[model samples]
Target chain A: MDDDGRDRPPVPTGRSERARTAALEAALALAVELPYPQVTMEAIAARAGVGKATLYRRWRHRGALLVDAVAHRNARAAVGDGRIPDTGDLQADLSAVLRAVVDELAVPAWDALLRALCVEALVDTAVGAQVLEEVFAPQITLFARRFAAARATGHIDGSVGDVEAFELFVAPLFHRWQLRTGALDHAYADAVVRRGCRALSP
Target chain B: MDDDGRDRPPVPTGRSERARTAALEAALALAVELPYPQVTMEAIAARAGVGKATLYRRWRHRGALLVDAVAHRNARAAVGDGRIPDTGDLQADLSAVLRAVVDELAVPAWDALLRALCVEALVDTAVGAQVLEEVFAPQITLFARRFAAARATGHIDGSVGDVEAFELFVAPLFHRWQLRTGALDHAYADAVVRRGCRALSP
Candidate 1:
């Protein structure tokens, strides 16, 4: 869970939050521009214009830095990103939500952080669980609520449960993202929503 | 692409193939039994019952070893496992194919190799490309052919391409697998197939 701690450094405090954010933003930007292996503490410090000691005191190495960068971004995104637009039309609402996600994902910062986080999750169960709870669990819960509302309104049918409906709504986009199989666009989002409505409706 | 090769050794040859195979199998077995960091070269050699040099002469470190192990296993599984039973019923045939995949994925060796390869792919694009072509591409191709047949029989619509059909068929299982959000069993397989059939049918 600790990932050997040779990499994890001290926890960021209120005093260090701004400094840490700056450093992580620099780290994520650099990571997007270069390969993960090449994004080093010294380079991040240089880019952030923070003292090398500032980074070293908080992060022992690259892994901890990247993990926390993604974690931090995810936490911030979750604050306002969770609100799905409600049009009462389940298809439009779901497509709108998915397209919003594509927009969020298209950001260079989020893109790099997500790619790095997915890699870390694959290597470390602690990170994986962290993402599941902090990122996916909340989204899934919201989607479930939406689906239930839709079902009550005669949008989605009773054939599919909330869990299955949520999976149907979101899993395809995630699958494409992880596998690098295709593009995530408005057209793709609409297609998924259309297919999902057909499958989930009676 | 090379992943810094500080740990990469020479390529294994004809004489070393046997040695390499044994060591990789042992490595994969131990990987399944333990964490990635703990699955060391010394431990693999000990478990494999080969000289340490036999391992070092071929693989420089753990990543290289695990990647090769997964690549080898994927190559072998692709030969026979890609054949989906054609029952002439679209829903039944897809369920059978997905169930077969669930069975293959359930194996300890395959599970471990897959987890290892996914992590390696995150760190190395060369390994990622190799997996795409060697592992995913073949299966996707076969699924495309099957979907085409289903289409010819008026099962699936011309609205969705073979690629979209394949994605709809398989992405849910992968999403569940990667996220550990649900069980991958006969019921799960059937649910996914049922949803897919409804979504894609003419």
Candidate 2:
């Protein structure tokens, strides 16, 4: 029906898309089911029902594959509709973002996957950089932009440093989660954003 | 030789304190030399010149042994004067603590041990809980107490939440160090305390 299209549904380019999705899903599932040290490319390929060569052709190593999977998962779940909502209330916006993070982190699969990635990153320097640059850094940038917007609107004190404010607001959540020291909840999220905003007040 | 002397050169106790020390040192050394997953108890014991049974007797598993070794190293390095140095300044106290932490964390052995422990903790729930309770929770408590003192002294607003404030000030340092994002330097430390104190001000 279309130019350069053969009959029989154009062989479904969706098949490759489905395969990639399935591979990522398999990687995440295996990460949850097995320890990070135990996860292997061969195992993921088998789990995804793709050949080993196919997976290797797509990703050079397990770290690369895993990082892509995490990035994909995060992009799918991130909030804000690509705009940091400015409700004339900085506190509300911060609270909303922080709460969304809390919800995303609450997913057991996410927790398991992050924990595995963190462990792998610690052991592998290249993977660590990739995870930070590709995954964590972007999230921080988004929050920093929102804080910058708030500053511009005069809702936040201009004296407050952007990077410091960004770290002050988000680091607590990750610290609590990574160290397993406390609960990462809506209550905690509300407190973080509230305290952070108040600190930034003129 | 003085009081409880039932000793003919103390028959080694079949658990030489020297052996334990050596094993810990070896574990830390090997962790840096080899990947964490490859640093087996057998390897540690061999490196320490002790029997595998000796290591097993003290630690239930490799994870437990590694956790203890890392915790012990942190404790030795963390010895301080136990004074929160109040120069009538909240920022001064925070600076002193942060400086001490910087000094301790600068040691290569400490960094390696911590990395190994952190990696193991991700997959091992018991080890993770132990590290949190024995290491992180205590450090957080110390900061919380100092914040509470600052609140009482009227230097900081009493209404500012202590726990959240502590995390806001300290988590970034750990995040940067553990995640290898940026240098944990004095300037950054000073900025964190200054901005964090302002943020918590009522």
Candidate 3:
């Protein structure tokens, strides 16, 4: 059984899977176009070229549909490669990842979708927890692993735990993005990594 | 000539000033009691023991009322005492302020209200910008000033600029608080300041 709670189907994919994907894509597109409250089941079904009954059969309500749509969209970018790029220099690899995040936030659609999802999550606790777990937690774990690896290699100070070090590096990026205080750029990433590395120096 | 833009009736002391303070307090109290959507002019007025007409006389609507409430609630605590406590040690001062922030977050009503305001701000750009300016910007400026003072006193590396250093030190705290990832505690604060100070070392 896969993590999503169903066994992997054999090859020769059927129309049902295609329809499900289409429905999610349509829901995501609609979420971007309209506010969370306005993204109705009927609209999603119509956009997906499926019937309202079909959408209802799968999702109990608009919030559930939005949740599934966001989850599906986030799964595509789920961070998996566990290696922390121990090229004898921890700072360089960390800088590379932080810079990538800055670039990712520059994409308008990603920022819009994230902001919308955050707003919805604020109102709905369950949805917020699910997003933190499925969408945000995975990325955090990846960074934690890297930090742990750096600690093992003595590239980082032994006293600094994985979680603390990870927060030190990534928290700043999210803070800047969420608050819109300043630009998240390569220069900022470099400063964070350099400062973080120095802090961890034994 | 009060900060709220309301004409003062020159009350040397007594009921009118108290009434104004009570109205703002009621607005803040109502935000925690009900979500921003459920809060209304009538509810705030009733909570404040003032008439709806009185609330309208002061604030045009619920948005204005809530904005003023948030502004009043956070004003004093957010701004440092125009000094960064330069005890000839950069790390200690930074850690002290960061720890205070952790204590601030532990106040249950504060976090919930901040989340609500942030969510509303996303949807309403004007309110969002105003909150950032009136609330968050001043705090960031204070940290920047501290960094400048630290640099001038030779405690920190003069090479690091004020804004960059400020982001390095403060972003992580806001990031952790806003995301609800981990505990914002003294240990984490100390680590952040220690690491940041080291990185900024000339």
Candidate 4:
């Protein structure tokens, strides 16, 4: 949890942390209730029982705040939990982890939020960087560590590289979701792992 | 091909084909010279010496027109030539083909057009579907055919299935290009093929 990649802004102590959580909760509620275009800062402020000034002070704009809300949810507790179990079988471990990823992203609330932010991120460079930092940076770090451990255990070849090899697990899912090329389901998740693990086998 | 998937309306016999080609060239030339937002239908019409109404009758909007322009160029002859050689060595064949994909997609003109369309596609379903049809659909179909051929030759396992196996060839490339997580190059492209081949080997 180095400060370098931790995009989650530090919460203030005591009452402010509660307020931040309330604001985030309100943002998530609004995000699920309406299209992201309709989820406004004013609406969030009203829903959270806070002033617009409070939001501006923290996130600067609705997109930033929304990115934070969705990403914080994924990083902390929701879909995209980076805590994958190490069962010593690379194929099964990757398959299970990717299946969980599919499940997490499949949740309607998180999916909508994620899709909206992704669209905005494609258009806006700052938002694009936010996507990398908030959603993927931590999880990708965890992947590097996992891959290193897998390599050391002789489960996967050292040639898979430390970090880029993780792409085998995620890129296919992203390709399907981003391009609408196919269904993102358990079958697809396991297939990705199967091919990836096979490719990187010792 | 059948007109069902044809996004481009048929050019009338004689002079209309020339007009359509001019309009497409104008769109592509403008696409390279100016940002996508700056390159509009009005500008394209003036550049191509066609009326604004003519552009609208064919394409609903700028994004559709641009996607058609890029795809039409690719389909006619450009990047995404999936005419992979069957060297009987599936690994070498795949590596070569994937490397070509890397080169084709890396074209500055094509990349700019693709990237612009990608942002718009994320927000607009129509545009998103167009992205799949215009750019990826043909290649995916081609991939299925290749994998099937490989399976028959015993270069790959029979268990990999039809279309889902295609992801092994493409997902990593799409992931890198979309996320900017890493560079898309010949080395990376070859690595993807290597890993994919390993994963699917009997």
Scored by DockQ, the top model is 4
Please, what is the whole-model Cα lDDT of each candidate in the order they appear? Answer: 0.73, 0.74, 0.72, 0.78
Per-residue error (Å), model 2, residue B11: 18
Q: Whole-model lDDT for model 3 versus the true structure?
A: 0.72
Top candidate on TM-score is 4
Task: Please report how far candidate 4 places residue A43 from its true position, in Å.
Answer: 2.6
Per-residue CA lDDT of model 4 for A91-168, tens digit only, reads 787787788878867888767777788766766668777777777776787778778889888888887665477888
Scored against the native two-chain complex, candidate 3 gets a DockQ of: 0.54
Q: How well is candidate 2 docked (DockQ)?
A: 0.54
Off by over 4 Å in 3: A1-20, A32-38, A50-68, A78-89, B1-22, B49-61, B78-84
Q: List the candidate 2 regions with Cα displacement exceeding 4 Å.
A: A1-22, A29-39, A47-49, A159-162, B1-22, B25-39, B47-49, B78-81, B159-162
In the range B1-202, model 4's lDDT, one tens digit per residue, is 2365443433546576677777888999998898778899999999999999989988899888887787766666533554556777887887877887788778776667777888778777888898888777777766777787888888888987655667777888877776777779999988888888877888
By lDDT, who's the top model here? Answer: 4
Provide the lDDT at A126 for model 3: 70
CA error at residue B175 for candidate 1, angstroms: 1.2
Per-residue lDDT of candidate 2, residues B142-173 (tens digit): 67677777777777777656556668777878
C-alpha DockQ of every model: 0.46, 0.54, 0.54, 0.67
Better of 1 and 3 by DockQ: 3
Better of 1 and 4 by lDDT: 4
